[model samples]
Target: MTKPITILVVEDEMIIGAKISLLLTKLGYEVTGIVPKGEEAILYIQQNAPDIVLLDIHLRGQMDGIDTAREILKEGHKTVLIYLTANTDEETFNRAKQTRPFAFLSKPIQPQELQRTIELTVERILVQREVNLQEDKPLPQETNEELMLLQDRIFVSSKNKLVKIFINDILYLVAERSYCQIFTKDQQFILSVPLKSVEHKLQTAQFLRVHRSYLVNIKAIDEISQNYVFINKKAIPMVETAKEELFKRLNKV
Candidate 1:
């Protein structure tokens, strides 16, 4: 069975702290600590690492909640810290956002918003776990084509290092000299391998050869116009020869 997401609540007011704790408990989370000040909250985090920390911006102690959150983040804890603030002004939100909390809930929290945020946070954690699993898995040469379909991951040699790549995150591949340049949603990597060898390994129907140098993920193409395919604002060359096949595959969708 999966353990409930343990949480620490740091709010100065006793009534608000208790109310927030009660709400989280009702939503199936375990409230590990309910402290009225930032100092105690930091101490609790030092002793025990919770899955998420719900921190109030204003606290009655040596440290303010924003500073406390930054300190906690610097300690290398993967805890999802969220901000609970009454200030909704653009400047206040901008300042709070600089810390990049998982979520920022307004004062007098709405149950619907709180529930949605918790759900999103948990789902994100699950996705990270899957990525970690892929990273930990061993690399094997003479690839198994079926592995990409089953695991959505690949281990490739890049600059003499084993690099783990989540295949679903990859949007396209471009062939460079003795290498394949992989482009994902957030980053790009170059792995040393022949383009043909990669195409052989990733022969799944999801990836199509739109051009001699480009293998594009069919699902990632956003639009097509005049031999140019748009993928999330990035233009990918679409040859007239491949356009017929591209339309054929897209029409089947």
Candidate 2:
């Protein structure tokens, strides 16, 4: 039999925290602890480690959620950090990405969303482990530029740290004022890059720039109508100019 996934909930809101904890248990995960602040959460992890951690961005006490996540990652624990927050602004999302959490869920999370996220995160962890086993040799040091290709499964470097991301696990990429919001099948990742810049890095056939503000992976697209394209469960608009190009790209894909 497989061992159950263990999760720690670090949230300030008691009532909502309890609700999420209950949902996690219902989804067949073990709730290690539900902490009400950042400092306590850190201490709990140091004492007893869990498989994953459900963290809230608006944490209480001296440290915020981001700080706690950074410290935890610094400790080199493989626990995947799933950030629970309502913020989606460019600055906030980029700051959250620096920690390189495994997943991100928006506020007012539905039960289905929460459960699917847990499943996907666990699968991602397994994939990473498999990839790690393939090559015993360590990655070389000192590289200036990176050429990453996001496919069914992918691994990329962020801040000199190697992070594996499953592309089929992604939903869409929303271009913010100066950053990009990478939404996955059950999560989101915000990166520091312009839409045009990231656009050039991708193979034009797989990723489509549906809107001036959105660049979506064609394979992850579920539906496309006259005006909008569906990425995972979210609807993103498609302007007239990009419509023909989008179809051509989709066909080529």
Candidate 3:
């Protein structure tokens, strides 16, 4: 079974903490524990190392949420920190900003907001995992298994299973050594094949080779500059020749 994302809730109010834990559980996350103090939160994190820490900025102890976050980073723990704040002054906001938290949730958290925040955080975690894998290990050449492409969608391996990704949903692709990372509107997939291989299989006029390492969908282009094309607000490098070709394809006055 897939291991669910684990979280540690650090809220001083027992009732609020319990409510948050229950909500998290219902959202399919594993709540490791709920601690009411920064000191206990730190101690629990030192051993548990949950994937995320939901910290309330105001606490009874000497260490506040920002202080706890600093200590966690100081201890070399790279966990996503989400701050919960009922009220914030300039000084507290500055201090919290210094910790570089993933997000901030106001008190009386709405279920939809919490769910959206966690979902975005999970996507970030997945992307970071792919980057770490690329840095830590050498990517092998094309695997024996090939990506299954259909008229409108493609299937790629993810978590030991084939996940369907519609062709129209693709934003762009980035080549890293022998691996290609396929990007869609909300998710990303890494395929053990070269960029050229995937491009050939795509076989569509909508997808253009914007750069040596990038293949972008024409419909997803938000802006085009001299040296880059923006897709979903992400700047992708573009070569001069490819830029000329892209301009030729677009209708301009």
Candidate 4:
């Protein structure tokens, strides 16, 4: 059986903390514990590492939520952190930004917003686990420049290092005779794999195979003609079947 996702709430106010814990329980997450101060949160996390930490920016003690998150992240813990803050000031925002929280939730949180954030966090965690497993494997020479897809981005093997590229940055992908070429706004990368092989792997909602030789980002489409789709001023041939599919996917209004 799959274990429920564990959560730790770190809020100074007792009423708010209790409410959050109750809501998490109702949402099917395991509420590990609720702590008032950053110091207590650190201690709890050290003893029982939860899958996610819902940290408030303002706390009861000297160490605020941001400081606690920083310490947890600095220690290389696998726990995902989400900041719960009513303080949206620039200074506080910059400090929290340094901690690299998975997502930020404003105070007086709605149930739908909280649920959505948790769902996205779970997706990211699952994707990270898959990427880590792929990274542990030995690289084959024939597939030197391989790409690992994640929830929001992809990791590409480049010069013996993994380079992170967000899906939003990608413009399109072109199928060469033997390899697949990935084009972003700044540079292009060639993966040592056939187009068919990549099509199965790039099975995301955003990417579409407009033709046998091209996979285009739906958001990157600049213009559409009868026979082609323009992306970054490059025309990619659109087959009759794919063109029909693309039009169906587009919003009517």
Candidate 5:
């Protein structure tokens, strides 16, 4: 029998942490434990390496969530991280982004959003496991129509088969109602999933949501103006707040 995915909840508030644990259990995942501090979380992870970690940003201990994530990586843990934060400030967001979390969940979490995020994360984790197992052998032909997201690349369905697209190659994504269009330098691909779903899968700091309908890769941007960002000579609209944040992120001098 295949082992069930294990998760650890590192939330300071016991009530909220317990609620999350209950939800995970209902979703058919094994909750390793719920710790209230980053110190205990690190110790628990050392003892029982969970497949995923749901970490809260503002903890009651010496280390905050971002610091804890750094320590986890420093210790060579392969567990996937998903951050929980009520604070949406740019400084906190940027610090958390530096750790490269699998996803970010706001406080007072919605059950459906949590479920979708975990499900997508699990898919990526399982795909990575398969790739690791087959490292010494040839990869099998892709027959599934579902898109597969990896750490640095994604397998997108195209012409009845899956095609590998490096994440860096993707310039931006535009949401068209229920569909999302991914634009690269020389190609474009349409996905059946919504923009939010794609954003959840992208854990890198390179991509930023410039508007409700657009997610742009900062590295691929050619120029930024007051109202728009230019990529490959294509102008994409940006919100005021997003533009300000982007300006702060870029080097001015």
Candidate 6:
């Protein structure tokens, strides 16, 4: 059996903290602790590490969520940090970006969004662990049945399990050193595969290799301008040959 995903909730509001803890339990996660202060949350983290942390940006005591997150992330563990806040100020958002938290959620959180975020975050963490440890081995054709490709979907390795994802959801893929950053409409994933390997697995004409380091979903393109095409607000440039192929595929009317 798989071990439960452990989480720590740090929200100053007692009622909200309790509610989050209850929701985590209902979602089959183990709640390590529900802290009310940034300093207290740090204490719990140092004493007993959890798999994930739901930290409130505005908290009691000297340290705010961003400060605590910086300290926690500096330790460099696989633990994922997600911010829970109602604050939407540019200064606070800019400060939070420096800590590189996995996700930022607003106050009065919806259960569905929370659950989805947790699930995807856990998957990313698990994959990162595998990458760090070099535990993923290439299996033979017959044995590598876990990852499957269908007409409209594909199953990719997420930790020890295979998770199915829709093809249409993929907006773009960017090379991250030896890994690939798979961007979807609302989420992103890191895959321990080369850019060329990803292209092979995709097996779809719509996913065009625009740049040597970027593969984009043609359907997701908002506009094509000169040497670049925009997808999800990102400008992806194409090589000479790729540019021609892209236009050929479009066959613009």
TM-score of candidate 4 against the unseen true structure: 0.59
Question: The CA-based lDDT of model 5 is what?
Answer: 0.82
- Model 5 steric clash pairs: none
Worst 10 residues of 2 by lDDT: 138-147
Which of candidates 3 and 4 is the stronger one according to TM-score? 3
User: Over the stretch 150-169, how does candidate 6's per-residue lDDT look in tens digits?
Assistant: 98987776555666779998
Q: Which candidate wins on lDDT?
A: 3
Q: Write the per-residue lDDT of candidate 3 for residues 1-253, one digit (tens) a residue.
A: 5346789999999999999999989998889999999999999999998989999998888998888999999999978999999899999999998998877889998886688678657755665567676658654433337899999999887766779999999999987567788999899888877889999999877889987878999999999876678889676768799998898878641
Q: Write the per-residue lDDT of candidate 5 for residues 182-209, one digit (tens) a residue.
A: 8899988766667788888896678899
Off by over 4 Å in 6: 132-177, 180-205, 208-253
- The order by descending TM-score is 6, 3, 4, 5, 2, 1
Name the 10 consecutive residues with the lowest summed lDDT in model 1: 141-150
| Residue 30's lDDT in candidate 1 | 87
Worst 10 residues of 6 by lDDT: 138-147
Model 3 off-target regions past 4 Å? 140-169, 172-182, 185-253
- Specify the poorest-scoring 10-residue window by lDDT in model 5: 137-146
Measured over all alpha carbons after superposition, the RMSD of each candidate to the real structure, in angstroms, is: 12.0, 10.0, 9.5, 12.7, 11.8, 9.5
Model 1: which residue pairs collide? none
lDDT of 5 at 163: 85
| Candidate 5: segments with Cα more than 4 A from true spot | 138-253
Clashing pairs in 3: none
Q: On residues 107-214, what C-alpha lDDT tens digit does candidate 1 reach at each position?
A: 988886677667656655554444454447663443322223335777765434556787777798877445566778887655546566778888687888887767
Model 6: how far is 118 from its true place, Å? 0.7
